[model samples]
Target: MGMTEKQLKSSNKPDKEMPLVQYENVTKKFGDVEVLKGLDLEIKQGEKVALIGPSGSGKTTIIRMLMTLEKPSGGVISLNGEPLWHKKIGDKLVPADEKHLRKLRSDIGMVFQHFNLFPHMTILRNVTEAPIHVLGLSKEEANERAVDMLNKVGLGDKLDAYPEQLSGGQKQRVAIARAVVMHPKVMLFDEVTSALDPELVGEVLQVIRDLAKETDMAMILVTHEMDFARDIADRVVFLHNGQIEEEGHPEDIFETPESERLQGFLSRFLNT
Candidate 1:
């Protein structure tokens, strides 16, 4: 599929001096278990970073924290250089109010491992609902934007179809369309292709690759697909024990990992 006019016009140009997302001394704990331990990370505008790790290595937790599904036990997350979990109250930082958090979170969008679609709504309606309500666009405007987004994901003909009518791959594409309709500055993809069959994973990954090429959104993906990560991500981060064990360009990380933990993790897939 050819890039849409909107995609053609989209630029990946980003401000080099400022990071689009920052995790500063971020920590998360549940009871006595620390899921994330004083981790720091940064994603520049238009950068694609993939988080890869063994199970329980805290890859998914990082994405969840960015989406505000979970709160940090310590430290701060910043979006566009402003605090995401806290609000400035006359030079003092305080936990953000609900209103403030919602406003700040509007710039982010997430896609989950499971396709979270409204079963009762048509594909088009599923995509349009958020823009109409959260973005306050008129119904007509939302519909137009939704249609364009669906087409971008190669689902223009499925607009009238319900969730059950689509295959697993198609449903995931619809989910991607729904998220893209909001035009989020940063997109969080948490094991997006993990739930699909082997044959179905390619189509969803293709959509993501196109998004990376066509738009400038900063994308953070937690994925097990090593080849896909190498192909799409500018940087690959291997997380272990709630921290970044090693990070570098895809070629460097995949070819010559310095950490024994990362080498062991990669060998499971690479040697196979």
Candidate 2:
């Protein structure tokens, strides 16, 4: 069966009318260069959003902030309407401490461009470890969940293989399964296919597309693949110079971009 036929099921149904993620005037800077400038974006529960732009456009930084891998220099980010980087201290909001951050981070999962798996662990172990330790699942429970996820990613037969043994696409699918098995409220994909070979990229993308279809978790993908963006996203955001340049339904953003900058940006991908 194809990757699309592999089912990654979720029990939580999303409340689409409510916002799941909010970036309120968020900003990020690395010394002299500001990577994000007063960025404001919201993602509703169960929505799939794609961020597309050139390098250094801050697309990755946005999701990195959401993943808590990078902290913003200004403004607030909220998960489920609660401040992500801040904690409620009596009547005032204070920068979140480790306790504050950890609680919220549990609700988020991120898959990076590189497959950051445990090289020595088998594929099943890599996928099961997090849920077992973090979520406090029994070894038996974690194994069952891991097996189901591995099957869903077309890696069931490769469960005993180590990361070094699997191909790039298969490793990425394992990474995806690892994240999804956590049952996070939000899933972030940061250029997941960028490190894959051209021939292998399709398999990883197909796994992601399958998960996107099955999960109720809000998904934010920072990618350069135009057709993948068109295929998997409900909304496409075009970023330029650390800000959202244009965003709308994929049809509008891909087929009828109003901004010259976006048109030029898409042309490079669409033309060749």
Q: lDDT of model 2 at residue 88?
A: 84
TM for every model, in the order presented, reads 0.93, 0.93
Q: What pairs collide in candidate 2?
A: none
Tens digit per residue, CA lDDT, model 2, 164-258? 98899999999999999999999999999999999999999999999999888889999988899999998888999998788888888888898
Q: What ranges in model 1 sit over 4 Å off?
A: 1-16
Model 1 clash pairs?
none
lDDT scores of the candidates, listed in order: 0.89, 0.89
What 10-residue stretch in candidate 2 is worst by lDDT?
2-11
Using alpha carbons, what is the TM-score of model 2? 0.93
| Per-residue C-alpha lDDT of model 1 across residues 1-272, encoded as one tens digit per residue | 23233222222454357889988888999899998888778788888999999988899999898889999899989999999989998999999888888987899999989989999999999999999999999999999999998998899999999999999999999999998889999999999999999999999999999999999999999999999999999988899989878887888889998899989999999878
